[model samples]
Target: MNLRRILAGGTATIFATTALVACSSSDSEDGEGPIRIGTTDASKSAWTVFEEQAEARDIDLEVVNFGDYSTPNQALSQDELDVNLFQHLKFLAEYNVGSDDDLTPVGASEIVPLALFWKDKDSLDGIEGESIALPNDPSNQGRAINVLVQAGLITLKTPGLITPTPADIDEEASKVSIIPVDAAQTTVAYGEGTPAIINNSFLDRAGIDPNTAVFEDDPESEEAEPYINVFVTKAEDAEDPRVAELVELWHSEEVQNAVATDSAGTSVPVERNAAELQEILDRLEEAERNA
Candidate 1:
């Protein structure tokens, strides 16, 4: 996560611009200041519900949208955002490692599982030597490979390992040509040709039907752990009264129902205890260190 390099990368330029605006507006704890939140545009519904909840609590809520995955953590680290709700523990850990920032998750949100979609085929075996598009980001690229392994389309040297990369691809089946493209471009690639795996967000944005996806990430499996989006803030802010209040609100029945009905299953709020969330975060942090 070279912030400069990532910013220079066109994928997240919109997020960077929004972060600049947020930083400019966050000069004081003035009565006029809103609790600025950084998140991807795909999670618009959750942000709407969060804004409503914040308003009900008399807290001004400002929602900032990011185009790429890297900018939210960067914005949060720079205090441009009070919090972010776009990435999972794995991505957060990677951000922490790359930026040396101490951010912590306050609550878990949806599990937007990655799916392998193809316009021409129903199964991986059926489309041999087919061109596949995958997210170029390291975390997602590795996760997509794991999905391929899970589907028995390919095998990794170590199964059940977190963040396995292409270097770890052991059994290379001749039919599959795993191509790395920008995560945001995966859906577009599908329209142009066959894509082996596309992030759920990209697929949804492209209007691809999830039910018709050729291969989907197993939401119930450990491999999908890295894709579970969560609300995150500075570690020191994790226990702040306001943070706790918002986390509780996000998990409330009202918000849960809103997510289910409004998101059309794009987001699945985690219904885990505080202790369990901590355990998951801790495990993911450890995995990131090893990776």
Candidate 2:
């Protein structure tokens, strides 16, 4: 609001304010300049297609790659990036809460489902007494548990929760020994012929064929809503015309084809409005506040 100081000044004060406002505006509007998008190597192939598709439409959308998961949100919040296509709702909520920033989603992007990889067993039924490795991160660990619970391999004492640890397992009713491993270690563990849970992003690095997944979760479910990847901008840009345009481009047939074909069906595109994403963020923020 205080873009300029007007001490009962003339029209010159008004011009300064106008310039500041324009400077702060998102690059997404009118395709005037390149809109930088932050993402990781996991979605590198799909984003390449998105970038190409965006350029042909007269929009200069650029994808900026980062090696670590923690860098993109920081870059976006600092205005070093225009928007980000890297994080899901729960992770974003956690980042927003932890950083005390107001970053919000402008559009829902995709839901990369978690898969269970088995070495010796063909199905969950034959995996009795096997020590199955799971991602140790909070959000992923919970999702890994849910996949096993749904597959009847394991049961949680607290069912339907977003994050359940190894302690939450109900030993009496479970069929497999669920073990926690470093999220990056899941692929290595699974590659050793040990049954394990692997996230879609890490499948390529782990050298695992996604087609060999014994079980996968329904990413469209209400429980999976928090896991949906999104195009996030600052809260102020939520309703920007350019943000809407970029989102529309993503959901268009051209980009959708790129997302599907380039990602090899790993990133499932899900179109959701800002309201739906905000609702989930609000709930998470409230939970954080209470905690």
lDDT of 1: 0.68
Model 2 pairs in collision: none
Residue range 175-245, candidate 2, lDDT tens digits: 88887998999888887888999987688776677878888888877668888888898886667666678
Tens-digit per-residue lDDT, 243-266, candidate 1: 566677788776777776655565
* lDDT winner: 2
Q: After superposition, how far is residue 191 of candidate 1 from its true place, in Å?
A: 3.6
Q: In terms of TM-score, how similar is model 1 to the real structure?
A: 0.75
Instruction: Give the distance in Å from residue 217's predicted Cα in candidate 1 to where it truly belongs.
Output: 1.4
Clashes of each: 1, 0
Model 2 spans > 4 angstroms off: 1-32, 288-291
Candidate 2 yields a Cα-based lDDT of: 0.74
Clash count in backbone of candidate 1: 1
Q: What is the C-alpha local distance difference test score of each model?
A: 0.68, 0.74
Candidate 1: segments with Cα more than 4 A from true spot:
1-36, 57-60, 64-71, 78-81, 120-131, 172-177, 192-195, 252-254, 257-264, 273-275
- At residue 102, candidate 2 shows an lDDT of 93
